[model samples]
Target: MDWDKLRIFHAVADAGSLTHAGDVLHLSQSAVSRQIRALEESLETTLFHRHARGLILTEQGELLFDATQAMSKRLDAASARIRDTEEEVFGNLRVTTTIGFGSIWLAPRLRKLYANYPDLSIDLMLEERVLDLPMREADIAIRMKEPSQADLVRKRLMDIRMQLFASPAYIEANGMPRRMKDMTQHRLICQAQGATQVSAGAMLVRELMTYAVERTLTVNNYFGVLQSVVSDLGIGVLPDYLQQDFPQLVRVLPEVESNEVPVFLAFPEELRGSRRVQAFRDFVVEEVVAYRRARQIAAQ
Candidate 1:
């Protein structure tokens, strides 16, 4: 089999568009099309079913893609091992996490990581959808819940909970709810039940909705909910970790909270020897330790 042709085919299959594949491969669309044609002729089979919308992989294409995907993963594993040779960490590191956690917590502390490794490029993907680490969709993931995927090296970062909070101004104006039933007197700002969120967080919001509050504001993510709460919109169901940065938010009905949600940092087994991953993991661990120690001191 032609390795060059296979590489082009893999890129087209991964991108599902000749133009996109060409752009990524730094070749013209015509050049990419010619290469695909040659590969199809050499294999004596149609790899992709051409359509107006985009290309779809045929059975033959799927088979080839599967092999290519495995090869890609192995190459990545080898690359990671090679990167462990030097103490210097300088390369693109793709990290994924929830929007709330990334924007509220992780993004603020990234300066230190950059300071330590000035040449490092960090791509922070903040979304609720969990990217497949093993598939190389993301190099590392900080998830709100324990990852169940196999062949992942995981670490528990901390325990988080969904609790009620409102800005001081909002609480002063609306009056804090003393009981669950009292929530009916105030507007409840939360991530809508329909939004993509952790099961535990969704359950917490769902339980809050059961109170049949007359006025409510439902946003898609915690960041939006927090924004509304801080603007004096209403009481928000938010993660406890937010309190560290948003000290102006006052806890409401402290007794009413969700079961603990475990925050975890995870990476593919392939990245076990990656210096970039090691650097990020150590930085996060150190930050978490300092955060916990500070919290304990505040309590004391």
Candidate 2:
């Protein structure tokens, strides 16, 4: 149970190659191999199975690796907490959200946040999968639905609805859909039916597909769908929030819309006092409020 040897073993097990682990640890491959051998001798067990391709963890090695992984995450959480001081918000903050919202909405508005806290570093993870917050997969998450995990500090940010949109050029060429049935005359762009998306968005796409549009383009993520629409490809089903950023996009078939999808912001309860988390939370709340106000003003 030498801590140094355990560290080397973790690095090798994680990388699956002594040379790669050596590169990361700044040690020679022979040196790393010596440490692993010492650790195995101390424990009287084999840690890895060697092969031409690389190393694979033995059953005992898997158990030890699991323990080391937990230890590493705990150390990271502690380091983050220590780095976060009350007087300054200077540290890395991992924020996870769907690709569409992160790319189209949040990324554009992040400059304001950076202006306020110039020292803050943000790692924005954009994907469809929900990362585990409690285990430190990500520090904070902005999800379409309320997080169901235990020991989470959650806040409802806003609700968004899926609606149809098309560029003015596309609408002019293809003609606007005066009614739902008019969709048959134009091409449709949307997230593929089996793609991972919020239930509300999928429902809207399904309802639109029922019209039997002749030409269709289906992308896996909303960013792609928005790009296609912006390119004058076809009418697309997209979140209503996009209107503020994409003024050129005309809302098509104003009467058609989807049920609201509630957006939530959440973090581990243990990070309740983290200044970095607080700053990000406050920044996001302000952005959402400003966006809402902008939409209201546009309506007037």
Candidate 3:
């Protein structure tokens, strides 16, 4: 019932040590211990089991900790909403995307975003896992396919296809594979069969495997596959967008490519009015437009 005591309890429960919690809350260890004792007295429950090594949360403590953790996330969400009301765009923006796209594409282009909003702090979480946007796991996400999560503001960013490519050095040494059947002579570098990736990429890799290439290398992510290709190890199945950045990578088997994989950018509908979200969404749209224009010009 007492907010201050509950706050102290949450901190102690989180840190598992009174001294550590005191260090965080700027309170003396004895004072923190006193507050925790008072909270337990008020609630008539033993929240933590004290041991020589450290404190372990009791069942009640675990339940209370869960509630406190939710409260913290809600508080963070409220703070973000409050900050968004300001005219100036600033504060932390958590963006989640696949590692290959985040590291190879979006990360390189983020210089322009930071240049425009110098105060904006971006936490770029790169993984295949789709973070819960509505629950505030991340502020925004750029995913390979449309997000199935409800109450999301989704936009199709662009479409990408998985294509075969090799370094100039590798092609020079092993010669180019002009047809899908010719792949047997070259080593294939690709994402592992059971790895987490878009369906289109997996299909492409499967097709490539049917060629029975003499040697092969499998990585868990496209970034690793790209690294091996660029290192002149072998031909790799990679996204077409990479061609713009790594111009030296020679496209292999021009007629062989995967079906288009739709790229989508999404955020919680509640974040529709968030200035930071809008700024980032607009920036990504602009980048996608510019990328398309660049590709068109190069074709000409």
Candidate 4:
């Protein structure tokens, strides 16, 4: 059987009409019709029944459609693997990551990656919104949440810990809260976009507030919130790793609630065996592991 004719038949069956299939495939309507007819003739079975509304798939057509769907996916995977092997690690890689991490962490390391692989090109897309990997919106993704799709291969890179912190000026201005109830007298900064008020910081504050005092001030970005706290505007929760950047900032509570956000690198499962994808994945894992270890030693 001609694969081209089968491909055309699959498109028409999926679209429900030759005209619609032609529009999708960027082929002439007549060409689509011809291909479908040829496919039906080769199979010696009527795959679709013509109706006033459109074409309806026969029972045989449904079975064929299922088989073709699997076949098409396998073919695409095989083709991608072959291309990856034949070509150098010189193609453009589309990477999607969170804005803060992309800018502060990944961007700096990417220069070394480029220096190592001079032929490789990268397109970094930094956004808060998660892109669809199955839809091919991005080639690779660095995300806090692990993707649930079975078609994706995910590797946990690191654990990011959240901590409550405030500048010395803010602490001095409001007076240090020895207990939770004392926080009510001081201002608190929180993220507006977050759904729950019970963040790691909030939980610690609320717990302390139960015995001491409490108050609140919500904001969006961590950097902005930290800046406000530094200027004696209020106190907020920030990533523990970020404290090194602001020497003036101090951990608010000695016994604050801490939670680890798992950082992951994800790619389509089909591309897991591809040479280029594997190479990049290995490089990224190595870099992140080294960075995490160095950070641990520094903290010690």
Candidate 5:
């Protein structure tokens, strides 16, 4: 069976029209029709029933479509693996990560990855939105939360602890909050990005709001929130490691709930066995683990 013809058939069946399928496949309408015809002839079965409105898949076509979709994914994965063997782990790696983590953490570490593998190309995209891996939007993703889907392969990278912090100047001017209840009297900055876990910020805000405490300001990104807190805009919660960089910043409440934010390294399950993907994944995991251990020892 011609894989190309099967691919064309799958596209047409999915699109429900030859014109739309052609548009998707970047082929002419007639070309799409020819490929579908060839596929049907090869299979010796009528795949689609033609109607006045458009094309509809037959019973046999429906079954074939299910099988073809799975086959296409497997074939694509196989092709990527084969290419990896020939190309020496040299391809554009599209990585998705959050703004703060990408800047302060991954960006710096990526230098080492480049140093070890000069041929490897990287396109690092930092955003709050999660990119779809199955759609080929991203080759790898570093997210705060683990993906629950069985089709994705996820590994827990680290446990990020959140702490409520403020600048010394702000605490001096506004008076330090000795208790969570005292937080109500002062202004607090909130993140526009919703927290998936009960981090310090989320916990503080939830408690404050439950008691009808007023929040001063809200920002979209963590970097922006951190900046606001640094400039003494208002007290806000931030990651523990982030405070090490700035001497002026001090933890506001040391007794806040400790939430372990599990960072994950995830990729499509289909690409798990690919040599290049496997190699890069292993390298990143090792680097992150070593970095975490070094940080622990330094803190001690």
Candidate 6:
């Protein structure tokens, strides 16, 4: 197969117009069209459906596009790994984690990481969706549950539990609930049961709702719940780690909390030698250790 033709085909298929694709590829429209024609003749099949507006991929084209897309991703992965020299850890490191953890816990600590590696560029992807680490959908992932995907090098970072919390002002005004059943007296803030959150956190919300509190406020994520709680709107169900960051938030009904959720940091096994991966992993591990120490001291 001709790599140049395939590359041109990929560009044409991606852009849906020879002119647009050629503009991107720095080739004339006729030259791009010639390559596509040569590619089709070599493959003995039409790859596109010619139309007035733009080109649409044929079935064969779709298959080829899929292959080309995978190839591109693999090439990108290889390029990234090659740039990850042992002497320096300075390049784009795509980090994926849950929105709650990314925004609340990991993001704030990134200031220190930046201070240490001033030249490092980070692409932080905050979402509940599990990205394909093996396929290079993302470079690194910090997930609540263990990644069952093969070919991933995973390390348990820590454990977290969902607990009830409220602002001190809210607690002082509404009085703290000493027991799960006492929650009926105040507004209960939490993530909706259907929201994309860890199973343990969802289960906690489900169990709490079984008490049938008189009033309730359900948000899509912990961030929103935390905002409501801090605004003194109500008590919120949030991860225990938040207490370390927001000390003013008072824990409520500590006895009623979610089961432990294990946090893991993972990257493709192929990235074991990647300097960027090692740097980020070490930074996170150090931060978690420091966080644990701070909490231990606070407890005493």
Task: Specify the poorest-scoring 10-residue window by lDDT in model 6.
Answer: 205-214
Candidate 4 lDDT over 1-300, as tens digits, reads 788888888899888998999999999999988888888888899999998899999999999998787677667556667777554676667789876567656777777787777877788998767887765667789887788878899999877766677878777777776765566777777555353322454455455446543456666555566667777877676666564446568787767655667788998977776666776788888887787777777779
lDDT of 1 by residue, 1-300 (tens): 999989999999999999999999999999999999999999999999999999999999999999998899778767767766566898888899999999888999999999999988999999999998888888999998888998999999998889999888887887888989899999999887888987788898788778888898999888898889889998989998888778778999999889888999999887888889999999999989988887788679
Where in model 1 is the C-alpha error above 4 Å? 15-20, 28-30, 51-54
Residue-wise C-alpha lDDT for candidate 6, range 1-300, written one tens digit per residue: 999999999999999999999999999999999999999999999999999999999999999999998999899899998898879979899999988899899999999999999989999999888999988989999999999998999999999999999999998898988788888899989887888999998998888878888699998877888899999999899999998899988988878888999999999999999998999999999999999998899999
- Tens digit of per-residue lDDT, candidate 2, span 144-201: 9999997999999999999999999998897888999899888889998899999998
Model 3: clashing residue pairs? none
TM-score of each: 0.91, 0.97, 0.92, 0.61, 0.67, 0.93
Least well predicted 10-residue stretch by lDDT in candidate 2: 205-214
Off by over 4 Å in 6: 16-20, 28-30, 50-55
* CA lDDT scores, all candidates in order: 0.90, 0.94, 0.92, 0.74, 0.78, 0.93
Candidate 3 structure lDDT: 0.92
Could you arrange the candidates by TM-score from highest to lowest?
2, 6, 3, 1, 5, 4
Error of 5 at 106 (Å): 1.9
lDDT of candidate 3 over 5-116, digit per residue (tens) = 8889889998999999999999999999999999899999999999998999999999999888778777777888888865799999999999999988999999999999
The 10-residue segment with the lowest total lDDT in model 3: 69-78
* True lDDT of residue 62, candidate 5: 97
Model 1 TM-score (2 dp): 0.91
